[model samples]
Target chain A: MNGSIADPKAVRRTILRNLRSALLELGSATKAELSDRLGVSFPTVSKFLGQMEKAGELLPVQLDDSSGGRRANRYSYNPEVMLGLALFLERTETSYIVFNCAGEVKDQGHAASVLTADITDFDALIAALVNKHPQISAVSVGVPAAVNNGRLIYIPEYEQFHDLDLKAHCEQRFQLPTVIENDMNAAVYGYYMARHQRSELQPSLVYLYFGQNGPGSGIMLDGNIMRGSSFFSGEVSFVPLYDQYNFGEAMRASHPHPRFPDGDLSVDAVARLIAVFAAVLNPHGVILSRHEANEGLLAQLEAASQAYIPREHLPAFILSDWEQDYLYGLQGLSLDLMLSREAGGN
Target chain B: MNGSIADPKAVRRTILRNLRSALLELGSATKAELSDRLGVSFPTVSKFLGQMEKAGELLPVQLDDSSGGRRANRYSYNPEVMLGLALFLERTETSYIVFNCAGEVKDQGHAASVLTADITDFDALIAALVNKHPQISAVSVGVPAAVNNGRLIYIPEYEQFHDLDLKAHCEQRFQLPTVIENDMNAAVYGYYMARHQRSELQPSLVYLYFGQNGPGSGIMLDGNIMRGSSFFSGEVSFVPLYDQYNFGEAMRASHPHPRFPDGDLSVDAVARLIAVFAAVLNPHGVILSRHEANEGLLAQLEAASQAYIPREHLPAFILSDWEQDYLYGLQGLSLDLMLSREAGGN
Candidate 1:
């Protein structure tokens, strides 16, 4: 069996494929176990393992004792061998991070530049990261807009981002796969991943990201992100709750005094604006975050939300404690997409 | 192989199992092909086919011709071998239907009984169905409420449905498998199944079902339903939309009524209610149905929804034209579950 495969590329692909299958099934596996399960000759498996180790694809772990025989060399995929880059672009700042395959944050970076400044600046920032870290395998960007087939369709106040080919630009620069998702959708994915890992809660989730602009929601049904037809399903800002006159006036009204003289309304004011919206679009819970969300604010919003429940039926409200790490969530989404493909053989 | 199996029960189970497997892999095998694939003697296969025919589980189709030989008998699974009953219970009426395995409607029944009505009446209705159609293999009931682990936690205005052992009661009386799901979740499933069969859309969906009470949402991510922590994630009615008020009340206040009495709302009132909800939660598209959404009502709702979206971005709304047969969707879910199990086994 070892001599059966002649092409080196085919052998490498086969080894990677088998290793992925083993990892997916058992989370980890030893070389001997993989050899037996894959029905490949032991020496062939050993050779592939050695090559993977040399390429930093597999890390040799401590040898496990065998029954009355020599110890077997145990190996696992190197988490750091490949990296994912995720960027969460807010109206005020851009949050970015590097994540390994196991979903651990390896490095983090942020820049306080308005996303609407210029597309060239955004490209430069991403290029700087790629130059700084060569191990990145994929890049995911989350923006506050409606995305249709990886294209930016609408960005409310930021008309500059409309029709931007963010995915193509990133992929062209880094020569890696790229994903561009709505900021709210990314928040939903981030919350879902964090909850799944840290809590024993049910896997289904409806995540509402309350920012100053408005509220955006993401639905996770049966542990999968629910993107509706046209990829704009979670847009909760349009639901009508108040008189069109009052709602429009409130939206256009000047920010109250010195706090926002620049006229950039704070999330709190947006929360108030959405309070009227909330009365109409009652959700399971509303999550507030400014890149990062705190428990105190969540509690405050939760209490405030209670006043709106007409029939004394208040849904649970949770404040996200996770670092306003929208980038990490994008990394998780990429990893999820990869893992799902591997698991389902699609 | 037939001689090797002595037990009649084993034979019956094997026939069922084989027939199901063959039907699932429709184009992959023929009766003769299955006979060879299962490694059963051809005569045994023939005999089992005969028995299944008597049981209405197998139907003889056109024969396949072998070169210069007698045409081989071709048999396929009879879709009507088993039946599923699906009941969608709303505040005002109950929509019920029976479906065959192929998702075709066999029969349907509707009643204008409120969900707040006595459980005994609901039971009586179910009993009447069982008496009328003794061949129903399973029953699935969809209610507009929050369910946690198969337990009804809340039913909003219909308090009588709260804490009801819906599953146990149905199963006990019919001695068949029964499942009770959130109505919105079931609606999403029905919508997804219908669209999947027609388009190349991604399997993940955020389904919003608009009604007078409020909009119900179901998240189907990656071909599976996402149930929230308490199995209530998709409960859109609780999502705070306007000025911290529930969307339902906000819509009522925003769109003042002259039609219905101050408190009692009509279907038109509900339609107006949904129009406001649709604006806030701009899902992929809103699905509208009458008491039991028919073709005419669906078109009307689609036309009405267009008014909500500014003349610029009106994504195509989908009308679920899947025969108005809830039972078929139930069967599809069951079949999908079974196929997933089989795929997992492989």
Candidate 2:
């Protein structure tokens, strides 16, 4: 068999890719540790690390402690490679967070609602942000609306933004790639990606997000977000909860019931939703986000499962920390955009 | 440029592959029709058709009469090229049907029951069928049970079949590849494939099968059947109807209330389920089988959608022909298995 030498450019790219992955996973690493972890020789690692540093891909942080010999410099990923603006539009507030390539928050601010009453304020905000940070690679917006192909299909209190085509509008104005997703769908995507990094998540799960607006689902099949035929999937807010139980009254402000039905996260509603999820889709697990999930709700869901589903067929119910998962989702998408640019031989 | 000659073996395989696909789609065709459709020489088509005919892969069914020229022989794909015993286990009676590579029904019969009580009888039945047809390709069984890894994880009526290891048992007994699927899962798969052939179905839809045993859901995403986390995605019978109503009573024969909650499909149980499906998944359409679905039910569902979901967010409700969807599903699976064998370079 003839021994062939590997391509030097390919080898260098592989080394860079491995180093970047390790940095992302570990947050920070020293040259010696990276060499040991990547199974590359110290001199070769040092050579590539020097080149990467010159290329502005790695940044030197503090030096690592050494026993006696000279200390090695600890390096963190150079997040300034690309910038992304993540806009999380809720019912009453539109939160904007800017993150560099490293998925670290660099800048953030909160503003008045931009989508419910009108999209004029949102248009102004984007124009100002684009002028402020012309270096941003992409813009991602997550809104509390039923989105289908970048158009707002429904948002009870925010009918003015219907058929806005905000994604197209943003792209046309900014000249940078922009993505607009339903807030709950984005959250579900972020939750799936986060749980998958730990390697404990199943290939399929549904994340139920209940916010000030209402309940919605983010369905992940094989760890990817599922947008139905028209991208109208996961509108859980409209899920009819027992026609006689005044579930609709919660939606109507006039005949207001407990806000639990309107994202209160109480007992019967959660239990019934879990049962329906189990019986309908049988996902490995269900993740509840931004809900008042407590031990009482968990107990009721489990006890009810015993009556409806078999002992073995019950799905695990998980309560997510009330963090801005939509921001994480936006950052993830921004990273994908940056990677696609590289894949296209940028 | 060097002109490459097609290998006769690959060419003949391609011809056979195309012919098989056409037969599955069109049901039957003549040699002249196939030649014209496939853009092959008439002589070549005749040569290969002759070989396939001799090998029982196809059969001469009827004659295509001509005005002046000699009458041509119309050939239909032989329904016994590769036989598959498809068993659809219901509550009381187990229906069996056999199909060929073209998914045409060959032979069928059913015993009193299978997998509900004991596997001893099922084992004997399988053994008898094996003896009856040694040329059978595979055996596909669809059981009314929530299956996890080919084992019955949940079955309300037949708790005895829980953890039965049914697929392994059939494989060991028949010495052939076997597949055991949730009854509703297969029905959904079958329904999806059948509708997709006509190119009129949606990319995402759910088939609700209400059998005598209970209700089950078959979810299809992008024309593919989705078996959630542990193959337990579609156990719709467990869906809670109301916060206070006894929806589980219908499943428990002893605690039977007035068949349905309130016996009025307009408000509580049925409408809510449809509304929930529309809100949560937003599938393009919903197919209802084995139910007393009528125009009144449709009117009520539309009215409820107006109350819960947006006008544009409603899914078209379809009533399935109450024949046997599970049988169609089993036939589809068996056909796939046979084609896979051929694709593996058999």
Best by TM-score: 2
What overall lDDT goes with each candidate model? 0.58, 0.68
Candidate 1 lDDT by residue in tens digits, B1-346: 1222133455445544655656644633456676656656567667766666676666656777675977776677666656667777777688788776666778887887648677787888878887787766777777777766456878777776778777877777767667777766666677766546421454544555555666566655555565644454455555443333344444445444333345343233334334544444334444544444667655565565454445233444555533342344555554543322211121
**Winning model by lDDT:** 2
Q: TM-score of B chain for each model?
A: 0.63, 0.73
Please give, for residues A20-72, the per-residue lDDT of candidate 1 as tens digits: 54654455677778776666657767876776677666665777777688887
Best by DockQ: 2
In candidate 1, position A51 carries an lDDT of 65
Model 1: which docking level applies? incorrect
For residues A215-302, could you state the per-residue lDDT of candidate 2 as single tens digits? 5578877666777655666665556555334333433333324433454434455566666677666777777653556666676768
DockQ of each: 0.20, 0.28
The DockQ of predicted model 2 stands at: 0.28
